[model samples]
Target: MAFSKLELFHSLILVLSVVSVQALTWTTTPFNPPAIPLAVRSPYLSAWLAQGAGAALNDVWPTFWTGSVVGWAGFVKVDGKAYSFLGAPNVPGAAFTKATQKSSQFTSTQSIFVLSAGPIDLTITFISPVEPTDLVKQSTPFAYMAVSAASTDGSPHSVQVYSDISAEWVSGDNSLTANWSTTTGNVLTHQVQLATQAVFTENNDHIQYGSAFYSTTNTVGATYQTGADVTVRAQFINNGRLPNTQDTNFRAVSNNWPVFGLAHDLGSVTSSTAPVVFSVGHLRDPAIKYIVAGGATQARSSYFWSQFSSPAALITSFLGDYANALSRARAFDSKVNIDASKISADYASVVALSIRQAMGATEITISKNSDGSFNKNDIIMFMKEISSDGNVNTVDVIFPAWPVLLYTNPALGKYLLEGLFRYQATGQYPNKWSVHDLGSSYPNALGHNDGRDEAMPVEESGNMIIMALSYAQKTGDNSHLTQYSALLDQWTQFLIEDSLIPANQISTDYFAGSLANQTNLAIKGIIGIKAMSQIAQRLGDTSKSANYSSIAASYVSQWQTLAASSSGKHVTLSYGNSASWGLTYNLYADKLLKLNLFPASVYEMQTAWYKTVAQPFGIPLDTRHTYTKSDWEIWTAGIVTDTATRDLFISSVKKWASDGLSTQPFGDWYETTNGQPEGFRARPVVGGHLALLVL
Candidate 1:
C-alpha cells in the first residue's frame, strides 16, 4: 500500500516544519548568498557575507551593512591542510583543501554552516548575541565564530583554525593614513585610528570614519599590517597560544587573505572528535567629541563603552549560554515563523532571516542627565539611523517598524515615542500639515531636519498620530500619551484640517518622489485622525473624541465617493481619477485597527486587483511602476486572516530575497518585476512583517 503524492509531500512538509522549529538552519544557494547577514549589532559595527559561495573567503570581502569592506580572514586548517572559510582562497599553499559549504542554518542571533573539506568535516558557526530586551548586550559590538572539526575514519589529528581581521574597520577607504598600534593590558588589543578625529561630521549612506579596535582572547601572534593592505591577523593554537610560527607570505598581494598573516592555533586531539572555540570582537566609536543637540557624540560613545563589559567577558557570557540564546531566538522567530511556515519554507525563510537584521538596524542609544540620572528619556532617544538617508527617528521609518517593536519589546517602542514627543515638545516640529521628516540626519538630534528640506506634509503628521495609537494598543503604556497629550492635540488638529484631502506632497516613500492627490496617503491621514479620536476617547475627552470621530468618518465617506472604482476592483491613486492607481496599503490598517472604515468587499476587490498587477518579485507599489516596497507588501497581505492570498505576497518576497537586485542587506524598496533593489536596504522597517501576528 502506498500513499498519494500530495499526502507524502504533506508529511515531508510536517517533518521539515518540526525540524525548523527545533533548529533554525537552512541551506544557501551555493555560490550566491543574496548577502548573508553576519554581525548586525548596530549601524556602525555590522558585517555581511557578500562573497559568492564556493569562492575562496579571501576572493570575496566581508562588508558592513553600508557596503563598506571591513576585511577578510578565511584561514582554516584541518590536519595541516589549509582550508578557506571566512576569506578568499587559500594563499597558494601546499596540501590545499577546498572547503565547500554543505548547508547554512540561522537563528535570529546566529548563522551556522557545515562545510565539507575532503576527509575533514567542519561545522562553523557565527553568533551575535543580540536580545532586544537586553539593552546592554543588544548594542554590544561583538560576535563569535565557533568551529568543530573531526575525522571521518576516527583517526588522531592535529588541526589549527584562525581569524584575520582587516584594517578597513578603521577608515572609509583602506588607503587612508591610519595610526596602528597594539595595546597589551589584560588582553591582546590592536587599534586603528584615522589621522583626523572626524566623528559624526558626515551623514551619508557610507560607513563611518572613526576609530576601530579588534582583540582576541588566549591567542598569540597578531599582525596589524603584513603587506601594502591593512589587516589584523591573530593566531591561536590547540586551545592555547600558537607556537612561534608566522605566515610566510610569498604572495603578498594588495588584496589577499594570506595564510601567512597570523595562524590561529586549534588544540590537537587524540581522537577525531574534538571541539574548540575562538572569538573576534569589534568596537566602533561614532560622533563628535562634544555634545550636539542632534545627539550621539564621542562622549556618549565612550560612556556606553564604559558601561559595557570587556570583549572577553562579553564573549564568554554570550558563548556560555549560547544554546539558550539560540533557543530564545528560535522562540522569538517562531512568532513570525509559525505563521509564515503555514505558507511554505520559502515564506518562513524570508521571515526568519529578516527578524534580527531588521530589528538590529536601529541602534539603541541610552543617555544620562547631568545629575547622572537615567530615566525613560535616558533609556532611549536612539538614532534610528539605518537607512540610505541616515535619517534619525523619522515618522515614516517609525511607522513601518512599529508593529514588531510594539509586540516584542513594547518598552522600546514606548521609549521611541518618548523621543519623538521630546522633540515635538520643544515646539520645533510644525504640525500644520505634518511635523519634521527627521530629528536630524542620522547620528544627530539637534533639531528637525525638515527645517532645511521639503516637508512630508500629511505623511509625517499621519504617521505620528497613528504610531501613537499603535504604541498604546500594543503596549497599553499610556503614561507617555499623557505626557504628549498637548502635542497630540496639535497634530490631531492638523489631521482634521487637511487629512480629508491632503495637499500634493510626499510620503514615507519620499525617495520615489512626491505625488499629489495620493489616495493611499489620504487613507493614511484618515486612519490617523480616527486613531487620534480613539486616543481622545481613551483620555476621557468625550466631546473632542466625538468631534474628531465625526470629522474622520466624513473624510472616509468622501474618499470612498471620490476614490472608489465603479467596477469595485481597486481604488484610484487620487480622488476622481480612475486612470491612475496606487497601493491602498494603508487601507488594510483600518481593518487591523477595527476602524470599520471600509466594506469587506473593498478589501476583496482591492486584493483581487493587486494579484493581477503582481510582478514576479512582488505586487508593485502601485500602477506607477513594477517596483515594490517589501514591508508595505507584507503589511497589505497581513490584513487577511488566512494564508491563502498572504502566501503569494510572501512568496514574492522569498523570490526577491533569493535573487533580488543584489546580494546586499534587506531594504524596504526593490524592483517588483526583476527584484532589482532601487534603494533602502538593511533598514529596520522590515520589522513590519510581524503585521499579521500583531493583527
Candidate 2:
C-alpha cells in the first residue's frame, strides 16, 4: 500500500488540491445539502465517492454536485461552492497503458450543474494543505481547466483544462493551460495562477503554488449571437489518461456525477449575457474530505440518471424500487428483532447495491408479430454469451432474476413469466417444455441468440412452475394462475411426464461448466410438482390440487430415495459422489417453498455446508469453481426458517457486493475464493437485492 516518496507526494498533492477547491465554496441553488463528514478514513472515502457518483442527482445535490479524485486533492463542488478536496483514492489495479495516459484503473466521477441557470458568472478555485500527508507526497504539481463559456450552437464549446506539463517541462513551473471556444460566437480570455509550495502549504489558503494557465480562444462568426438564451455547458474532462476520449465527460460543472444530467441539459445563454466565467481553482486543504465523501451521493445519482430511460429504465426503476423495499425490509427486521439472523445491515446494503448495480446488463424490448399476437422481447441475460458474444434471453440468466423479482414485486415476476409462457405456448420448438431465455439483452424478444434451446428441461420448467406458485403465494393473487391455466397445465404435464430431468444440460453455473446434475434435477422436479399443486390450490380447483399434490408426494419420495445421504442427509449428485454433491448441491431444501414437504434437517444440510466448506466471503457454487452466486444464496435462505442461518447467508452476499471499493457499476457475481467482483454489472437481477424481503 506504500508508494515511493516521490509517487506518494505526487498523489497526495493531487488528491488534496483536487478535493479542497470544490469543498470550500461549492454551491448549487435552492439549498446546499450537507457534505460528507471529512474525518472518515480513506477506504470509506472511496466508498462514499463511489456511492455519490453512482446514485441519482435529485436525491443529493438537487441543483448540482460533482465528486472526483484527481492526481492531486479530490474535488467536490455542489451548488457552485467547492466543498472538499481530499487526497486522491488509491487505484489498486493502477497500470499505465501505452494507449492511455491515465492508469487502466477506472475514474469514478459525478456532477450536478444548473441545466437552466439564469445568466451568471461561475468560477471555481482549489488549494492543497500539507498537514495530513507528507510534503514529498503532496508535491505532485497538477494542472486543471474550468469551463469559461459553453453555448449550445450546432456544436457547444468544450473546455479543456489540464496541468500544462509542457510548461513545467520547458519553464519548470508546472503552469496550467486552459482552452475554451464555442462552435460559433464571441471569445473571452483568462489567466492562470500557480500556488507556491509555501503558499499552498502555509498561508495562501484559497489559491496557492501549483501553476495555472489561461486561454483567450473564442468562437467567431457564429450563427447565434450573445443575446440568445443558449444552453450553457459546464464540462470537465479527465485528460490524465491519453486518448483523452477515454475520460468520461461531465456535462455540467456541478458536483453530481455524469448520470444526473442524462435528463437535464446545460442552460442556454443569450448574446446580451456576458460569457459564462467558470472559476478554475485547486487546493490541498483538509476540508477536501467532505467533497471526497460526497462522492457516494454523486455515484448513486449518476447511476440513477444513466439507467433511468426506456430500455434500461424498466430494470433500473424496478431495482431502485426493490432497493427501497429492501431498505424497508431492513427497517421491518428491527420490528421483530428476534429474527435478526434473517436479515442484517450487511444484507440491506447488498440488496440496495444490487438495485444500484445490476439491472444494467440487459436490454428490454417488445415485438409485434404478423399473427397479431405481440411477442415480448426476451431480456438478454448475459453481457457476453459464448454463442452470441453479448446477446439476450439466455435461459440461464432468467433463472437468477426470479428470486429478485419474487422478493420485491410479484407483478414484474408475472410479466416475465407471462413472456416465458407465451414462448412455451407458441415457440417454434416441438417440446412443451418451458423455453430457455427468449432473446438477448438488447434486441429484446427478437429470438434466442444462443442458438440452442433449454437442454436442461427440468431446471427451467421447475423455475417457471415454482416461480408461478411462489408469485401467487407472495402476492396473494391467483388471477395469473387462472389466466395462464392452459400454459400451467402444459408445463405441469411436461414435468410429470418427461421432467424427471434428462441427462446433460446447462444449469445456472453454465460458466463453471455443465453436467447432468441430478441434484439440480431433483430441485427441479420437486419444486415443479410443488408449484403445480400450489397453482391448483390457488385456483380453487380441489381435484387438480389433489391430483398435483399426489404426484408431488410421489416425486418427493423418489427424490428422497435418489438423493438421500449416509447420515440421513439430503445430498444429490449425478455421479453419487458425496464430495462433488457437497460442492455442487446446495443441500438446502426449499422446505418453506415446498410447504415443509421435507424436514428442517434438509435446510440444516446447507447450514452445514456454510459451516464446513464456506470461504471467508462465500461458499463455492460447486467443486468446479471458486465462485458463488449472490442470488442463489438468498433464494436458499428464503426457504430457511432459522433466522441465524439465513442471516449468515445474507452476510456472505453482502461481503461480495461490498467487497473492494469496486465502483464499476453493480456486479451480480463475485469470486467466492477472494470475494471480489467476478462478472456482470448493472443487471436487473439486482431485484434480488430484495431477497431480504422474503423474510
Candidate 3:
C-alpha cells in the first residue's frame, strides 16, 4: 500500500512541527490533536474545540462531542480592545480581533493554550481533574478554565477578561425555551436550564433535565449579566464590564440567543496579576435510574452529593480548590509521562492524550435516601459506552478500558465491574453467557429483564472473567469474586463448552461481522477458563481448579493447531482460513493475567507477523478492512516481546493522534492506512492505550 500525497504532506507537517517545538519547554509536545477537550467532565458536561486546518482556538466554536455547538466563548479586553481568544464567529459589534495562538499543549488532565493579545500574553488552561481515588472530588461535574495574562513587552497593561455560556448549553434543541437566573453570594452563578425539564432523557447527547452553571468568585471588580449574546458581549466589549443585569424574559435558545456572562475587571495586569478563573458545569439530580434486585427502579445521585450538601456547596468547593487540583493534575501528568516515556517517547504521547477521554466517560453515583441525601456506601461508577452505543456498563467496553482503570486505581476497575456483576446477580439476565451491557441506553440501568439484549456469548463471558481476575490481582481483593461466585461459575461453565471452538457468533469486534470458530474469540474463551481456574484456586476449591485447568490446557492445544495458518506464520482470523488474519488482541489477557496459556514462540511469531502487515498509521483490524481499533492495537502492542515491534505499534498510533483527519474527540476506531476516523470517538476504550503502562 502506497501513501497518498495527503498522507505524505501530513507526515511532513508532523515532522516539522516536532522539530520546530523542540527548543520550547512544554509539559507535553504540541500536536494537532483531533479535538482539544475544553470542559469534558461527564457525558452531558462534555465539550471540545474541534481542531481543523490551522487548529486555531479562535477559528471555531466549541462543540459537544456530538458535533453540536455548546456556546462557550472567551474574550480578553487589553486596554479596552476586545480580542476573541476561545470561540469563533466573533460576537458581532464587539469588533473582536482573533488572538494569535502561540502554542498548544495538553497534559493528562489539562489542555493549555498560549495566545497573544496585543502586548499581553494570555495563558488559557482548561482543567478537568482526574481524581480516580477521591470519589468526592472526582464526582463533581465541574471543569475549570483559568486565564492568566502578563505583558510580553515587560510593561503593565490594563486588562479585563470576559467569558460567557449561551443557552445552547442547556439543551441540544435551539428552539426550546431556556429559563435562566443569577445567584449571588460568595460566588456569582448564572444558571440556565430548559423551561420544561425532560428527566431521564437526552437530545443529541445533551441531557435535557440538567441546569448549566457558569460561575466565578464574587470578587470586588467582578460583574455578571444574562441577556442576548450580542448585547452582553458588546456591553463588556465597549464598557470593559457587564451591566450586572439578568434577562427576566425567558425565551427560546434561538430567540436572540441568551447568554450567561461574567467579567473580571483587572485594573493593572502584569506578571504579578492573579489569574481569572471560571467554573462551568451541569447539575443533574437523580443522575442514573438503576434497577435493584427486586426489579424496582432506584434513582442514584452523583457521589459528590454525599460530601457537598447542594449544588452550590459542590461548586464552591470545586472553585476554591483550583490551585490544589491543578497541582495534583500536573503531578499526575508528570508521573504518567515519566512512566510511559520509559517505554518510548511515542508511547508516552499516546498515553498522555488518552487519559482524559478515557476517564471522562464515567460518572460515580450513589443511591439516594428518602430524604434526598445520598447513600455513600452504595456507590457504583457507571460508564456511558459513548459514541458507538449509549449502553450503561458494557462488559466488552469495560474490558478494553480496564487497563487505565486498573493502573490508576484498581478499586475503580472493581467499581466498574461491580455494576455489571450486581445487575447479573439479580437473575434478570436469563442468558447463560454474560449480559452484553447493563442497559440498552445510558443513565438507565434498567436490566434486560426480558433477556433480549444483544448476545456476544463467548466474548462477554471471557471479558467478565478476565476483568474480574485482573481487578482482584491488582487490588489483592477477591471478595467480589467470592461474592459473585455462582455467576462466575455459570459463565465459566458456558466458556468451557464454547472454549475449544466458538460457534457462529459476534466477538467484541462485532463491527467486523460474525464468524464461526473465530480464532481470537476461541483464545479469549480458553484464557477465560484459565482465569476461572485461578478464581477457584483462590477460593480453595482444589477440585474445581484442577478441572478448569485441565479443560483450558486441553482447549489451548487444540486452538493452537486449528487457529494457526497453514504456513505456521501467524494465527488466522478464524479457524481453517489460511488467508485470514486479524489483530488477535485477546492474546494480551493471557500475558496480563500471567496465565502463560500460549508459549513464548507464539508471541514472537505474532510480533514478527505484525511488522509485515503494518500500515503507516497502524496494523489493520483484519484482512476484511483497512481500518483498525486503536485500543486493540495498543493491546496487541503490549503483548509483543520485542522493543522494535512494540515501538512500531506505538509510534504508528502516535502519528495518527497527531494527523488524524477527524475533528472530533480522540477516536478509538480509524483507518490504519490514512488515519481517518471510521466511526467511534470519545469512547472510554481509549483506556486500552495504557496497556503498556499496565504491563
Candidate 4:
C-alpha cells in the first residue's frame, strides 16, 4: 500500500523529534540475513527477527526458528498517539515508515537488537542463561526477552509498549482452543494453556503437535481475546489520567489469542537514559522436562518466573552483566572476523552469520541422577538439515559438527561423543562393526532409529574414531575413549580389514548412491587408522601405536598408488574407476592430527584439480552430480594454505547463504549451478564452516 502524505509527514516529525545520542548505537553491516536470531535459547523456545523492504520494525515479525509465526505483535502509545513498533498488524493512523532494525552484536549465548522507533528508541535483547561452564543454564529452556525504552526526542513523552503472543506457540496453530488465566504478581502476567494437555505427540522440526504456554509479562489492564486474536492491553496515560485497572488479577479460562504482554508504564522521560526492562518467557510442561533435565525442572521452572521481576529489578541477572557479555562476545566475533576478513566480504558475512546458527542448532540438557545429584549428561543431537527425515544424532552429521564445538570448547566436543558412546554401551545397535543413521528421529530420541535402511556403516565407524582422537588431542584426556575402547578397537580393526577395499557400502554422501572403492571413503578410513595410532601413543601403548602407525603409513603409500591412474593428470572419483573425481577433503585430517603421513603432492594435486571442476554455487559433492554439500567444500578448501582458493569456495557459500528461495538458518546442500537450496536447511552441519578456524 502507498504511504499517505500525512502519515509520512507525521513519521518525519517523529524522527526529527528524536535527538538522543543513545539512538542507533549499533553498527550497520552490508549483508542482512534472512532473519536475525532472537531467543536462540533452546530446542523449543527460540525466535528470530524478520526484515522487509521498508526495513521497519513494526512491519517485521518475530518468527520461530522454523519460520513459523508465533502470533506476536507490539504497539506503543506516545502521548495518546498509538503506533505499531513490532510485528505486522493493521492499525488506523499507525502506518509510519518502519524503524531501522540492527543487531549490534551476538554470540552463542546472547543477541541484541535496537530499533530506532519514531520518537523513542527500543532495545530488545534475547539471552540464554548460558555461562559456558554451567551446563544446567545451557540446557535450560527458559529465555529472557527484555525490552527497554528511552525518549530520543529530548522531551517528556508517555510511552506504553506491549507485545501480544499468538496461540500457535501452543499447538503450531491459533485455531486450537486456548484458555487464558491472569496472574497478578509484582508484574502483570497473562498465561495461556491448551485445554488439551497432550505433549510430544509427534517427532519433527515443525512445532505441529506439542502443547506449551505463551505468556507476555507487564502492565495492569483487562486481558481478554477477540475471536480474531488473543489480545492483552496495557495502557500508559498522561496528565493524571490512568487506564482502568482490573480487580482480580487472577481470572478464569477464556478463548482469546492465548496472548500475554508486559506494560512499561514509563510516566515520562526527558533525558536519554536506559529505562526499566519489561520481559516475557515461553514455558513448557514438566513431563518432557523430566525426560531431558530430570528432577531439576522444578527449580529451573521456579527460577524462570523469578527472573521476570523482583524488588527493584525487572530483568534477569544476565542483563546486569551486559557490558561483560558484549565485551567477550565482541572479542570472540573479532577473532573470527579477522580471518573472515581475509576472505572477500561476501564470504565473511556467510561465515559470521552461519557460525551462529551452527552454535544454536544442537539441543542440550543436563540430567539429575536417582541419587538427587546433577550430572551434565548433555545429549547433543544435530537436526538433519531439513532432510524431513528428522533423523537424530546421525553419525555423519556429528562428524561435520565437531569442528565448531572443538573451537569453542572441547568439553562440548565430548558432549557429542558421549551420547554415541552411551548408545554403543547399551548394545542397542546390533551391528558389531558399525552403527545406524541416528538414535531416533528428533524429540523421540530414545534409541537408534532401527527401522530405516542403514547408510554410512563404514562411514560412521571411521568418523567416530577420528572424533575421539581429535578431541583427545585438544583436551589431553581420553578417559571417555577408554570407556568405549573395545568398540574403538573393533571399529579401527574393521577399517584395517574390510574398509580399505570393501564391498559397496553407503558412505556419508549416500544421496549420490553407493560407489565402489570410493576414494574419499578410503581417505576417511586412512585417517581413522592414523587417529587410532595417535590415541594408542597417548595411552602409553607404544608397541601398538608403532604397529598401527606402520600399517597406516603403508596404506597411505598404497592409497596414492591405487587412487592414481597410469595416465596424465589423473583424477579419479574412486579407486581404478577413472570416470570422475571427488575431493580428498578428509586428507586435511593428517595435518589436523599433526601426523605427517601424507605427502605434500597429495594436497597440491587435489587443490589444483578442484579449480577445473568449480561450478557457480560450489564444487559438486563429486563429479557424479551438480548438487553440493557446503561443509565438505569448506573442508576441501582447507586442503591448501593459499588465501585466494579458499575464498573461491567461501564465496560460493556466500551465494548459498542469501539464496532468496531458501528458508531460515541455512542449508548445507544446494545446487552448484545456481544458488537454489537442494536440501538441508537449518542443520548443525553448517558448523563445518568453522573448519578454517581450527586449521
- TM-score on alpha carbons, each prediction: 0.85, 0.52, 0.96, 0.81
Q: Which stretches of candidate 2 lie over 4 Å from their true place?
A: 1-342, 358-395, 448-451, 498-502, 567-570, 582-594, 661-663
lDDT of each: 0.62, 0.39, 0.87, 0.60
How well is each residue in 536-646 modelled by candidate 4, as lDDT tens digits? 888888898898888888888888888885563544678887667886778767767778788888777777666666775667888788999888888877776565567
- What is the per-residue lDDT of model 1 for residues 1-695, given as tens digits with 9 covering 90 to 100? 89853344345444533443333223542113356766666566677876322222334677877777677565566665666666543332233445776676665566776776556667777776657677766666566666677666566666666555655665555444555454443344455555554556542343445545555443443222233222222223222223333333323122342222334454554444433444445454533122334443323442244454454455555545556765666676566567756756665676666766766655555554677543323545354547556666776777887776866677777766666676667665444544553445566655553456458767777787877777777767777668888877877787777767777777887766777778888888888888888888888899988988888888888888878766667788777777667777787668667788766766777767766666656788876677888888888887644455676677667666655237577666889766677767778887777666567
> How do these models rank on lDDT, best leading?
3, 1, 4, 2
Predicted structure 3: lDDT: 0.87
As for TM-score, the candidate ahead, 3 or 4, is 3
Native-structure RMSD, model 1: 5.7
For residues 1-695, could you state the per-residue lDDT of candidate 3 as single tens digits? 89854456446646844753453333234466788888988988888988743466777899998899988888889987889888885566668788888888887898899889999989999999999989988888889999999898888899999999999988979999989989999999999999999888988778889899999999988999999888988888888898889999999999999999999998887674677899999999889998888898888888888887777888888899999999999999999999998997777877888888889899998986778666778879999999999999998898999999988998888888888899889898889999999898888999898888888999999999999998888878999989999999999999988867889999888898988989889889999999999999999999999999999989988888898899999999888899989998999999899999888888889998987888878799999899999899899988998877787777778777777367879998889877788888889999999998887
User: How well does candidate 3 score on lDDT at residue 511?
Assistant: 92
| Candidate 4 weakest ten by summed lDDT | 291-300
- Window of ten residues with lowest summed lDDT in model 2: 99-108
Tell me the lDDT of model 4 at 157.
79
- Using TM-score as the measure, the top candidate is 3
- Ranked by lDDT, the better of candidates 2 and 4 is 4
